[model samples]
Every structure is written in structure tokens, then in C-alpha cells.
Target: MLAKARQSLRAACDQLNIHPDVYEELKWPRETLAATLLIRMDDGSRRAFKAWRCRYNDRRGPTKGGIRFHPNVSLDEIETLAFWMTFKCAVANLPFGGGKGGVCVNTKELSQTELERLSRAYIEAFAPFVGPDRDILAPDMYTNGIVIAWMADEYSSITGQASPSALTGKPLAFGGTVGRVDATARGGYHALRHLEKSLEIDPDNSKVAIQGFGNVGYHCAKLLHADGYTIVGISDSSGGIYDEKGFDPLAVMQHKHETGSVQGAKGHGKTRNITNAELLELDCDVLVPAALERQITLENCDRIKARVILELANGPVAPTADRKLTEEGHIIIPDILANSGGVTVSHLEWVQNRSGYYWDASEVADHLKKTMERETQAIWALHNEMSLSMREAAYIHGLRRIAESVEARGTQAYFDGA
Candidate 1:
């Protein structure tokens, strides 16, 4: 993942004519932290879990990212994720940098009590490293608002005061924003909406295949469906469901909730249960890979049938696939820009927490729509001007801002003498 991320940055840097020093700095993280978390399990035996946090770049402002809990978590993955967040924040025009944290554990195996203890234990170990003015952690995979609230509570307990601003993605009773749950998808929807006209996609007739049926994928598919787009394919970790005619996303969700996965969701006459990879290659007008990283690569890039790809997952398309997809004339809305809605609203939650004021969901949505549209336009404009791929344009847009910030500080390199 880190290699692919650096490769993407290098591609952008090559076009930007960036200084070697700046390019090197952008390729590596500022700090990567690892912790051994000892937590007492329900069985009363203490277990050690591997935890990691990476602050990639703070040239823009205090770093912000999500804390994930998964069995596959690793320092390398977290570091690369943080690197993407650094660019993701800047691409969205947010006044924050990038940070990421995660713990290695099978969250499905833990009870609620054990989960709470683990979440709080994570904060207790990293309290000094996180704050509103420092690295702020939100919810990611296998983590949610309650987990965020637990971490925030732990941070407050450690500091002897309320620290709502120390984190975002908490339950509304704590400090989470109204539109946050759907913000990631909504933001991608708004950004993707702008490309519809230029890409000549008619939502009323176009087919969209979503690779992940999680929060971001589910919401994006739902929103696109509501906006008159035909959602012909949707998938979860277990498998996917496909039909030539559109399927009701919410109904599929309901079926999945009743069963164990969407694979059981009954499809119409031309229905089939497909693997995650097969879902990506479905013949559709738009493909939204809201799943994990490296879904699109050179191995499968040639099989991608979608005219437009909305990346709601970080690093969904490998750097090698970028050139392949581009050569095939596919338009990709990079994850940094496409899935930035979550962090954008995270900033909103921070604002409301600091000011002790909250906006209605509509107000938040309006601001988000406008913000994503504006930022999307900037990258789109750049892509047109330079004939660069969407991902490269996004990196350049972010790198330029970060370069200005680094130069303004003038606390490091003296080559430019800013």
C-alpha cells in the first residue's frame, strides 16, 4: 500500500516539477507510533494487542483520521493510510492534515464489555499523542460512534475535563455531527454528480455497481439510486448480488440484515451471486469500489467495464492500475477526493464542538455539497488543463497546498528561502 501511495505521489510530483527534498518528505511519514496494549479479557487473562498510529504530514494543520479495529491491522497499512489522509484532507480543502490509527484484533470475537475496555485502553495508552490541537481519531472499520465516545471519555478522564473536541464521529449525545453517518457517501455523490454532465452519464439510465455494501457503499448506492441512477450491482464481504435491472439498495440491506450477507438477497430473473472481484468487472456505467485498498490493479484493470469509477475506499486503485485504466479511457474519482466527506464533516463536528453550536442536517448537507463541488471542480479543472489522470490531479492539488504550507513555515529546508 505504501509503495502504491508513493508511486501515485511520484507521478504527480513528476508533473509538478517538485523539488527532490519536498518529494522525499511527501513520500515518508513524519512519525509512526506502535504500542503494545495489554487488556484484561472477559476470561480474566490479559492479552497483548498490536496497535499503531501514523501522523503522515501536518504541513496543513493538526492531523485527523480514523481509528480502525480489525484482525488484519498493521503498522504498514496504517502508515500508508495516513499518507493518503494527508492528501485527502488537502484535496477536500480542509484545514487539517492526515493521521491514522488501528489495533490488531478480531473485533467480532470480543464482547461489548471487552470492546469498551479495549477502546478506552487504546486512548489511555495514546492520550498524550492525541487532542483537538493534535492528532484526532474518529471511527473506521469495526469501530463506530459508541467506540469513539468511549475513547473521548477515556481522554477526558485522563485529562480531568471534558474533551469532546479531542475526537469526532462520536454519538450525537457526545459531539458527532448530524450528517456524519452518511457524509462520506453524500459527499461522493455530490462530487460524482458534477462529473455526470462532463462524462455524459445519464443517471436515469446509467448502471452503478458498488463493490462494498458497508456504510459508504450502502449510502452512496442509496443516494445514487434515489437520484434516479440504476444500481444494478451491490456486494458485501460474503459476496454480491447482481441483476440487469436495478435492485433496491435498502431492500438489499434489509435482506442482508435479516440474513448474514447480501448473497442471500433475492435477485430478479438475471440474478447471480458474484465475488468481490467479479463485482468490479460488472458491465456498468459507474463502479464504486467502497471496499478495501488495491481492488483495482494491473491484473484486473483491463477487465474493468465501468466508464467512471467512484473510489469511496482509500487507495482502492493501485498506482499500476492508474495508467492501465487511463489508457483504457476510464475516469476515476480518486478516493482522497471521493471519500473525503467523512473528514470534511469531522471538521464540522469539531467546529460545532468548539463553538457549542450545531447545524441542522440540511445545513450541513448544503455546506458539504458546495464544498465538495467546489473542490471537485478545482481538481477537474486541473485534470483538463494538464490532461492528467484524476488521481494525479488530486495529488498535485494537495501537494501544491502542502508545499505552500511547508514553505510558509520555513522551519526546515532553506533551499527555497521562503
Candidate 2:
């Protein structure tokens, strides 16, 4: 996955005629640390879990990304996510680079106490590698506010200083900024809203199908539905639910909360259960893959019917599949540009943390709206001007920023008397 992502970067570099030093610096992770976190289980036994952290690049500033806990978490995945984060921050013009961390474990299998021990142990292992001005960690898959609180508290304990800035996505009382809970979804929302007219999408008539029912996906559906879009399909890890006449996001969410899945949720019209794969092929105006990576790959890419794809998850659309979809006239709102709201708000949290001043909810929303619209518009302009796919254009936009920063310190041409 990292190699594939690098190919895209290489292509962008070639298109931009960027300094070779820029590609050299961005091709590989600057540093990656791996550790075995051993913890005591509830059954009086010890178990070991593999963990990794990759600071992909810090050319812009300190690295920032999330720590995910999942059975499928791998070093390659972390590095790739970090690489994406590097571009994501640059795309949003955040004063940070890219970094990511993960543990190979299923949170559902662990007791709360065991989870706490594992979280602290992770902090203990990577204490030397992370800081406010270094690599900041946020919550990702299978991790949430309580988990972030544990990690943040452990970092404080290890450093003997309250360093809330070391982590984002914390509880409000713990110095987390407002508007961050839905920032990722809201960022995509802002981008889509900005492009509605350009994409010829009418919220009153268009249908939306979301592949993930998590925080980001739910908020995305809720926001779009509120704006008069008909949500035709919704899915979670368990399964999916579809309706032709659309469903109310709040009603589906209430059902999901009560039943632990969206499979049986009721909609405005006929609601039926479907597989996650089927949700991707549903005829809709917008398809939002908010769940996992590589969901719309070569096999399923051909069957995708949505005219536009809003990627709220990192690497949800594979590179080859992205090309096919774009060639097929699908307007893909690339993940770097679409789902950068989380990191943008995280940057704001970092700023608020450093200044010891917190913005109100409205202020945070306003900032996010402005940043999302500005970046989205810039990327859209590049897409049209360069006749490139939105993904390619976004990469060029971010790559320009990163390459400029890299060349500012002087490239080989400067050293060679160009």
C-alpha cells in the first residue's frame, strides 16, 4: 500500500517537475519505531501485542496523526496512513507533517482495565518519540475519547507535566477543542457543499449512500440529510440498510444505537438489509466510504454507480480503481482533500493548547468552514486548470507546498550552483 501511494507521489512530482530531493525525502518514512507491548490479562496471564509508530515526514513542522487499534493494523498500513496524513496536512495547509501509530489488537476482546493498561503501555513505549512539538497522536479505529484520555494521562504521568497538546480528540474537560467530534465528516461535508453546483448535484433530488456508520459516516449522513439530500443507503461493519425513498439520518442512528447495527433500521420508504458490498453499488448521486481502506478496489470499482465519491476514510479508494472511476466520469472528492477536517481541527486544538485559549463551537465551525472551502476551491481550480483528476490535482497542490518547504532550505541545484 505504501509503495502504491509512493507511485502517486512520484507521478505528482514528475507532473510538477519538483526537485528530486523532494521525492527522495517523501518516498520513505523518516523514522518508524516498533515495540512489543506486554500486558497482564484479566485471567492472570500475560500477552504481547505488536505496536508501531511512523513519523512519515516533518518538513512542514511536527508530525501529527492517529493511533488505531485493530486486528489488521500493520507497519505498512501505519506508514501509508502517515504518508497520507503528510499530504492531508499540506492539502489543508496545516503547520504539521504526517505521522501515525497502531497496535495489533481488537479492542472488543479486551476488558476496560486491560485496555487502560495497554493504552498506558503504548504511551510508555513511545514516550520518547512523541511530544507537543513532535508527533501528536489522536484517536483512530477502535479508539475513542476514553482511550485518548488514557493515553494523554499516561503521557502526563511519564513526563511529569500536563501535556494535553500531546494528543487530540480528548474529552472537553481535558482540553479538547469543540467541533472536533464531527470535524472529519464536516470537512467532507463542506467540500461537497462547495462543489454541489459545480458537480450538478441537487441536494433536493440526489441520493447518498454511506458505507460506514461510524462517527464520521453518521455525521456525514446527518449533515447531508439535513440539507435535503435523500440518504438511500447506510452500512456498518455488521451489514447495511437501503431504501429508495431515503431515510432520516436521526431515525437510523436511533435504531443503530438501540440495535447495535443499521441492518434493521427503518427508513422513510421500503428499508431492506444488504451487504456492505451491495451498498457500494447502489445507484446514488454520492457514495461516501467512511469505513476502511481499499473498499472500492478493481473488482468492485466497475460496479460503483455513484457519480461522486466522497472519501471520509483514508485510502478508501485504491489508486487503480480511482483512475478507472475518474475515467468513467465519477467525480471523486479525494480523501486528502475531503477528509482533512479532523486534522485541521486537530491543528486548531494544538494551537488552542499552545495559547491556552479555546474557541467556541461556532468559532471552530467557522474556522473549519473557511479552511475547507478555501482548500477545496483551490484544488478544484487546479483540477480544471491542469485537466487532472481531483486526486492528482490535490496531490499536486499539497506536493507544491511540501516541495517549496523542502527547497527553502536549498536543493541540490542550489548546492551545484544552478
Candidate 3:
């Protein structure tokens, strides 16, 4: 995945005839660390889990990204995510680079005590390389506030200082921001609002279908639905539900909360049960792939009919599908920009934590809206000025920022000399 991602990014730069040195610098991560986390289970059994942290670059500032825990976690995957984070932070104009960590373990298989021990062990192994000024970690797939709080506490205890800024996405009681829970979706909402104007999308007449009913997808559906966009379909890991007259977002959320899926939600329009793949190809004005990566590929790209594709999930569209979709006139809001809200709000949380001050939910929302709108406008302007695809424009915009930083810091010499 990391190799593929690097090739895709370099291909974009090559198409623009960017400097070879710049492309070379962007092809590899600045640092990659792999560690084995040893923990003793409650049953008196000892186990070791493979974990990795990849800091793609810090040309902008400190590295920042999420730490995920799952059975499929691998160094290549973490490197790919970290590479995306570097560009995502750049697109959002955050003073940070990209870094990501993950452990290959299913938390569900561990007892509560074992989980805590594993979290602390993972932190202990990576402590020397992570800090508020080095690499800041946040929650990612299969990792949440509880795990973040544990890691933060362990780090603080080991270092003998209360460094809340060392981590974001913590519990509110532990210096987390009030609006952090829904920041990703809310940030995407702001981007979508700007998208509506830039793309000339009619909100009232637009139909949206979201895949994945997790934190980002659920909130995106609610916000867009409240803003008068018709939410025609929604899905989870199981299946999808669709309605032509538009299903109620709130009702679907409530039903999902109760019944664990959107399949049985009460709706009047033409209803049908569909798979996630079918949901992606549905005839909707907007399609938001909020699940995992690689959902849209050449095999399925031809079936996508949406006018706009909002990638709420990381790498939801494969590189091959990117060109196909663009050729078909589908304006894809790339993941880096579309899903940057989480980190944007995480930055806000770090600010509040360091200053010992906090903002109301409305204030946070306002800041998020302004930042997202500004970034989206800049990207769109570049796209129009250069007559570039949105993806290319986004890459150029972000890569230029990072390249400028590299040049200013004289790090370009590293690539030039190499």
C-alpha cells in the first residue's frame, strides 16, 4: 500500500512536471520504527505483538497522526496512512507533518487489564521517539479515547511531567476538546458547504448516499441532512438501505443505534436492501465513502454515477479509479482534504490544552468552518487557475507547501546530495 501510494503521488507530481528532487523527497518517509510489545496476559501467558510507527515527514512541524490497533495492522499500511497524513495536514494548513502507528492485535481478544498493559507496553517501547514536540498521536481505527487516555497517562508517568499535548483525542476530563467527538464529520460539513458553492451543487436537489455508519459517516449524514440535502441511502458493515424520497437521517441513526444497522429503518420512498458495493454505484448526486480504504477501484469505477465523491474514509478510492472517475466527470474530493477535519480539531484541542483554556462548541465549530472554507477555496482556485483535476490540485497545493518548508530548512540538499 505504501509503495502504491508513493507511486500515485509521484505520478501526480510527474504529470505536473515537478522537480525530480521534490518527487524523490516525497517518495519515502523520514523515519520508520518497528517495535515488539511484550505483555503478560491475565492467564499467566506472555505474548508479543508487532507494532510500528512511521513518520512520513516533518517539514511543516512536528509529526501528527493516529495510532490504530487491529489484526491487520502492518508497517506498510501505517506508512501509507502516515504519508496521507502529511498531505492531509498540509491541505488543512496545520503546522504538522504526517506520522502513524499501529499494533497488530485485536483488542476484543484481550481482557481489560491485558489491554491496559498492552497499551502501556506499546508506549514504553516507543517513548524515546514520541513527544509533544516530536510526534503526537491520536486515536484511529479500533482505538478510542479510553486507549488514548491510557497511553497519555503512561507517558506522563514515565516522563514525570503532565504532557497532555503529547496526545490528542483523549477523554474530555483529561484535557480533550469539547467538540473533538464529531470534529471529523463537522469539518467535512464545512468543506461540503464550500464544495456546494465551488461546484455549483444545488443542496436542496442533491441526493447523498453514505457508506459506513461509524463516527464520521453518521455525523456527516446528520449534518448534511439537517442542511436540507436529501440523504437517499446509508449503510454499515452489514448492508445498506435506500429510499428515493429520502430517508430521515436522524431516524436512520436512531435505528442503527437500536437495531445495529440501517436495513430496517422506517421509510416511505422506494426501499431496497443493497450491498456496500451496490451502494457505491447508486444513482445519487453525492457519494461519500466513509468506510475503509480501496473501495473504489477500476473494476467498480465505471459503475459510479455520482456527480461528487466525498471521501470521508482514508484512501477510499484506489489510484486506478482516480483517473477513471475524473475522466467520467466525477469530481472526487480526495481523502486528504475531505477527511482532514479530525486532525484540524485535534490541533484545536492541542491549542486549548497548552493554553489552559477551552472554547465553546460553537466557537470550535466557527473556527473549523473558517479554516476548512479557506483551504477548500485555495485548492479550488488552484484547480481553476491551472486547469487541473481536483486531486492533482490538492497534491500540488500540499506538496508545494511541504517542498517550500524543505527548501527553507535546507533539507532539499539531502535529496540533492543523495
Candidate 4:
């Protein structure tokens, strides 16, 4: 995954005439730590889970990223995510380098007590390596606010002091900032709305199909639906539902809550159960892939009909398929820029933790709106100026910032007095 992701960096560097030393430094992670977490199960059995943490780079500031709990977690996946986070923070112009952590375990199988124990055990193993000034952790994948609270409490216990700054995404009573729950989706929404005129999209006539009904996906659907767009299709991990006449986001969500799937949700027209693959190919103006990586690949890129794709999930489109889609004139708002709101607000949470002051939801929303617009406009302008894909433009924008930081530390040319 990391190897494939590097193609974008190389292209950006080549376009910018960047120094070789910058590419050399960015190609490898600065440090990665691995450990096994042993937890006693509820039924009097003990299990061991493999885990890893990687700080890809820290030239900008302390490393920042999330810890995910999934059965497929591996060293390669963790480091690749950290690599993307490094670029993501740079693109948002946040003072953070990329870091990510995860444990190889199915969170669904664990009871609440067992989950808490595992969360704390993760901190116990990595406490010495993490700090507010070193690597700050947040929630990701199967990890949520309660899990983060447990980790923060463990960190405080280990350090013999209140250390809320060591983690973000905590519960409200602790250190979490307001407006964080929907930040990721909100960021993408702001970007898409900002470009509506340029993209020739009218919410009144546009249709949207979304894959993945998780936190980010549902919020994206709700915000867009409220703004007058027609939601024609929606799906979760299990299956999908589609109707040409559109569906109400709230109603679908309520159905999901009651049934644990979107299969029977009602739409204005004939609602029918479809596979996740079918949802991606539905006729719609906008398609949001808010699911895992590589959902759109070589085999299915030709079948996609959406003129615009808002990537709320990280690396949702594969590199090869991305090239094909771009070549075919599909406008893709890349993940580094589109899905960056979570980390942008995570940075806000870090600031509040240090200052001991929190902003209201309105204030946080305003800040997020401005930041997303500024960055999105900049990348769009770059894309037009260079006749490049949005993904390329975004990478170049971020690479410029990272290259500046790398060069500031004195490259070989400076030593040779070139």
C-alpha cells in the first residue's frame, strides 16, 4: 500500500522540482514500534493480539493520528495510514506529522469490560513513547469516544497526572471538543458546496449515491439531503438499497438502528436490495465512497456513472482506477483534502486541551467552514492551472509545504554553497 501511495509523492515532487533529499526522507517512516497485547477474556480465557504504532515523520511537529482496532490490522497497513496522515496534515497546513496505530483483533467479539481492558493495555504498552509533545492519539475504525476515554484515563494513571493532552476524541466531560462528531463529513460537504457552481451541480436536480453508512457516510447523506439533494442510494458493509425516487436520510438511519442493516429501508420509489457494488454504479450526479480503501478498482471503474466523487474515506479509490477515472473526466475530490476535517478538528481539540478552553459548536463550525473552503479553492485552482487531476494537485500542494520544511533544515545544496 505504501509503495503504491508513493507514486503520487513522486509525481508531485517531479512537478515541483523538489530536492532528492526530500523524497529520500519522506519515503521511509521515522520510527515504528510493535507489541503484543495480552488480555484475559470474560470466559476465563486469555488471548493475545498483535499491535503496532508508526510515526511516519515529525518535521512539522509532533506526530498525530488515530488508533484502529480491526482483525486485519498489520504493520504495513498501520505505516501506510501514517504515511497518508503525514500528507493529510501537511495538506490541511496543520502543525502535525503523521502517525497511526492499530491492533489485530475483532472488536465486535469483545465485551465492554474486555474492550476497556484492551484499550488500557494498549496504552500501558505504548505509554513511554506517547505524549502531547511527542505523539498524540485519536479514535479510528472500531475505536470510539469511550475507548479513547479509557486510553486517556490509562495514560493519566501511568504518568501520575491528568494528561488529557496526550489524546483527542475523548468524551465531552473530559477533553473532547464540540463539533467533532461530524467534522469529517462536514469538511467534505463544505468543499463540495464551495465548488457547486464551478462543477455545474444543482442540488435541486442532483442525485447522490453513497457507499458505507458509518458515521462519516451517514452524516454526509444527512447534510446533503437537508440541502435539497436527492439521495438515490445508500449502503453499509452488509448490503445496499437503491431507489430512483430517493430516500430520507433520517428514516433510513432509524431503520438501520432497528434492523442493523439498510436492506428494508423505504424510498419514495420502489426500494430494492442491491449489493454494495450495484450502489456504486447507480446513475447519480455525486458518489460518496465513505468506506474502506480500494473499493473502486480496475474492474469497476468503468461501471461508475457519477460525474463527481467526494471521497470521505481514506484511499477509497485505488491508484490505477483513480488514473482511469481522472482520464475519463470524472472529478474526484481526493481524500487528503476531502476527508481531512477530522484531523483539522483534532488539532483544534489539542489546542483546547492545552489552553483549557473550549469553543461552542457554532464557533467550531465557522472555523471548519473557512479552513475547508480556503484549502479546497487553492487545490482547485492548482488543478486548473496545471491541467492535472485533483489528486495530483492536492499532493503537489502538500508536497510543497513539506518540501519547504525539509529544505529549511539545510539540504546538501546549502552545505555545498550552490
TM-score per candidate, chains pooled: 0.97, 0.99, 0.94, 0.99
lDDT of 3 at 215: 84
What lDDT score goes with residue 24 in model 1? 70
lDDT computed for candidate 4: 0.95
Q: Each candidate: what lDDT?
A: 0.90, 0.96, 0.89, 0.95
Q: For residues 301-418, could you state the per-residue lDDT of candidate 4 as single tens digits?
A: 9999999999998899999999999999999999999999999999999999999999999999999999999999999999999999999999999999989999999999999996
State the lDDT at 52 in candidate 3: 94
The local lDDT score (0 to 100) that residue 412 gets in candidate 2 is: 96
Report each candidate's C-alpha RMSD, comma-separated, in the order given: 1.6, 0.8, 2.4, 0.9
**What's the best-to-worst order under TM-score?**
2, 4, 1, 3
Of the pair 3 and 4, which is ahead by lDDT?
4
* Candidate 3 lDDT tens digits, 66-137: 999999888889999999999999999999999999999998799999989988998899998899889999
Query: lDDT by residue for model 2 over 1-418, one digit each (tens)?
Result: 9999998899999999998999999999999999999999999999999999999999999999999999999999999999999999999999999999999998889999999999999999999999999999999998999999999999999999999999999999999999999999999999999999999989999999999999999999999999999999999999999999998888889998998999888888888999999999999999999999999999999899999999999999999999999999999999999999999999999999989999999999999999999999999999999999999999999999999899999999999996
- The number of the candidate with the highest lDDT is 2
**lDDT (tens digit, per residue) of candidate 1 on 343-401:** 99999999999999899999999999999999999999999999988988999999888
lDDT of 4 at 281: 93
Could you give the candidate ranking by lDDT, starting with the highest? 2, 4, 1, 3
Position 201, candidate 4: lDDT: 99
